[model samples]
Target: MLSYNSLSLYLQVVINLTLLTGLILLVRNGIKTMEVIMLFLSGEFALELTDLVDRLLKLNTLNTYNYALSQFLGLVMLTEIYSRYFLKVPAFVKWIIYGYAMIFLVINIMDIYHRAPVTFYSNIISSIIICSFAAAYCVKILQKGKVEKSLFIVNTFVFLFFLLNA
Candidate 1:
């Protein structure tokens, strides 16, 4: 007796998980920085894992909190990893990013548990964050002079879908 909405969301989760996995495998043979890219890919996979968990089970307040926190953490880690491809960020900056995201994650967990709504505009705000990361990923592809056109388009498209659904 699955509802259409939940089924659709789960399907999207599966789709994203597949794409991320494929991209990770495609880049696995690249030299030098392949290991780092693989690490971020695994981080991306974590999002799918949490999304599946939230969608399959009866989600309570704690479950919702964890779901949001997973998205928050996943975006932060993936973006920080991606920033390496675009910007010449310092090592200290990475630590700072992790620290800031952890702080926000804790606050968000509390907010979700307390039924305190988010202050950062809306869920659309997180969508914007994802879009921005996708942009950064595009820049990396461009810098490398690779034809990552499909990846770029699909990333933006998927982010927009989530944004609208949010």
Candidate 2:
């Protein structure tokens, strides 16, 4: 029987493969949002693959950095997705997103310099931010009473995933 750690690694690999396949299909079909999703998936897959390799090789040095970087990138990508989805959102909302991103970056940099493991805080903050964006999108859809089926599906999944993870 596989150990828990081994099983999780296998699961991650499966997920990465699935994401890669979906990304390829999206690219081929030339979806308008393909570029954003493509970049996000590509970064995520690369980071995940690196992490898997690092674990298998037992090179544990960069694990914290890898995790932190992945979380940061995930937040940025999700923000971009939501910003595009809610194009009519107020100017202040965009400013808030920008401000939060800057603060997050500063926190990550300070943590790295001080050799502090800050993934927990970063993860929580990012999750909340992402969930907020997803929720806002959902509200907008409801108010409009017309849904972009694809975006609604994506937003729903993102909201649930981040909410649970948070």
Candidate 3:
């Protein structure tokens, strides 16, 4: 019988593969904003794939720093994705977003390497920012009052995922 972790890992693999297939189909539709999201998902898939291998080989330490890297990269790409696709942030806002991302990455790395106690700050900040952006997107669509059914479903799923995770 497979353990819970094994089941979860297999489930994640299936989800990632589905995402990859969806991305491929979306690429053919020529939605340029999805390119960043596609890249992020691809990176996420690679990380999870390596994690599956690590579990099989008992090489846990091989992914010690990878979680932090993936989180930071996700934050960075989500910022770009939201700014470009959902909201048109001003230039200065973009600068601040990038600056915060850099600081978040640096603090995350330092905390990991130095065993600093302030590591959670980066995680909290990133979560809050991303959640806020997701909320803003939801609000914007709601105000429009004519969102397509497919978009509404997708938006709800994305918002709920971040909200629950955050």
Q: Which candidate is the best by TM-score?
A: 2
Write the residue-wise lDDT of candidate 1 on 3-119 in tens digits: 876776767576566647555554654534445545655555565565566666755565566656665655565555556544455677666656766666666767764544662
RMSD in order of candidates: 5.0, 3.5, 4.0
By summed lDDT, the worst window of 10 consecutive residues in model 1 runs over 113-122
Query: lDDT tens string, model 2, 84-144?
Result: 7654556687677767766766677567655444656767878888888887787887788
lDDT of 3 by residue, 15-119 (tens): 556556645655665656466766866776677567667666767456546656766776778777777677776778778878887776677666655543455
Please report the TM-score between candidate 1 and the true structure.
0.59
Which regions of candidate 1 fall more than 4 Å away from where they truly are?
Answer: 1-8, 27-32, 59-62, 89-100, 113-116, 119-123, 136-166
- Clashing residue pairs in candidate 2 are none
Whole-model lDDT per candidate: 0.58, 0.70, 0.65
Question: Candidates 1 and 3: which is better by lDDT?
Answer: 3
**TM-score-based ranking:** 2, 3, 1
TM-score of 3: 0.70
> Once model 1 is optimally superposed onto the true structure by TM-score, how far is the C-alpha of residue 6 displaced, in angstroms?
1.9
